[model samples]
Target: MSCFEVVDPLFGAYVLGNAPVKQIATGFDWVEGPVWFGDAGCLLFSDIPNNRILRWSPSAGISIFREPSNFANGNTRDKQGRLLTCEHGTRRVTRTELDGSVTVIADGYGGRRLNSPNDVVVKSDGSIWFSDPHYGIMTDYEGFRAEQELPCHVYRVDPSGEIKAVLTDFAGPNGLAFSPDETRLYVADTGRMFGSDPQHIRVFDVALGGRLSGGEVFCTISPGCADGFRVDSEGNLWSSAADGVHCIAPDGHLMGKILVPELVSNLCFGGRAKHQLFIAATTSIYGITLNRRGAQTP
Candidate 1:
């Protein structure tokens, strides 16, 4: 069966279905947050329900990166190469230092405990962005169920140690990413999973003072919703949808899709030249070669 459904000619340039989809590993409860470490030649991802982080490399295959990872949900590397992780069980974002020490990045705002940091991304400006949703706290499967004190919001943590609630108008803020040029921000609002409304990716303009404006629905994923995504160098978005991965153009058009056997939760660009698309699906990690390169961090 074909893996790609090209809706536009531009999508054809990126979808190379001739390259077979490879399964790197399996047997996880639920996998998400795939980040490629070129320097280490390994990929790290979260098995949220398992409450651990797993590592996979071409030479070593699969091993435990971190056991009892506080039910970590999402992770990304900073420009300085530190691992920034969002912990659902702890309801905080943490940084793993080069020396292997973990530091707390953000856990609470204004003395009120955060709901749960879901997905995280580092901006070129040295600011950290993350989504706060109650998914982790809503069930005992992923994390401890507790009373939520903060509303669902996306936060920006600056280098100077200031945390700002950038966006607070969503019922559930799930995944977040910046455009290739860092001029735009795309965040997934997955409220539709619990209700009947708000199930699209919202795009916003990144302003001069680290503020956001122009909150508009960029596109809607049918048969599912966008959970996490990354942008190609050309500004095309590869989002994790229920069916598989949906490729959305910069202009909010459904370009194409890569159908995985399992539902995808998140993805990132990896490999030597950064064209390899690593997907975190329900129970396995899948990858395929793509024609476009992912927009790398500075």
Candidate 2:
């Protein structure tokens, strides 16, 4: 095991430095999707098989934020600081209001139900974006096995409540993140439910009107799949993979790796200063302090 080090200055040589894979908490059955609630001073993550959302904090440790979560997967916060979530069981994107009420955002497109909303993100302008794949519907473990009513596609929900398909024809879209400037989008193509030959992250330029254009390959992972990811203020991409967490530079180059004991599912930045990286791995949750804070939330 390696000792954890705090790499200061975002561009330092040790930014992607390895550290001991300390297991903060365990006993989760298939953990996925994580987001920091700085205002609440807690970290929220999904326990898919348990159908609940778990909360962790420096003081509270672990607690149940919500039960019967409808197999929520990915989570993020909107510009108004509301919690946006993708629920696989319900095949819908929902927003949790400050008063604790859940509002359904989008569950259908073009008169058909979504396959299964996998991961989600909120743009600075208050639009919601998410990936729809059938992983949840095809399995009885993560969520209820249901027949998919629509093809898998990445969808965008405008601020005006209009839902539209942004990208089609991906094998299996897993996770996505926006560039620091919100001018680019990075989406992970996990591909065909564990099939070979198409597991990579694709980058798309966000047009002036927020439409995606100039789709192109961003970078490919080696011996692992890029599941979910986030970007830093310096434009570096931090993503989860089968092996661990891989940090990629803005120029689409591999920089370093943070080895965890399990296949990482998702991660987010938190802490009093928002410099701590909290990861929800397959079976446990781990965290490390970084010298620099993450980029401002989008």
lDDT string, candidate 2, 59-165, tens digits: 97999999999999999898888888899889899999989999999989888889889899888878889999889999788888888788789998888999988
- Estimated TM-score for each candidate: 0.98, 0.94
Report every candidate's CA lDDT.
0.92, 0.84
Instruction: Give candidate 2's TM-score.
Output: 0.94
Error of 2 at 34 (Å): 0.8
Clashing pairs in 1: none
Residues 20-114 of candidate 1 have per-residue lDDT tens digits of 78888999989988899999999999999999999999899999999999999999999999999999999999999999999999999989999
Model 1 lowest lDDT segment of ten: 191-200
Q: Best candidate, lDDT-wise?
A: 1
| lDDT over C-alpha atoms for residue 255 of model 2 | 72
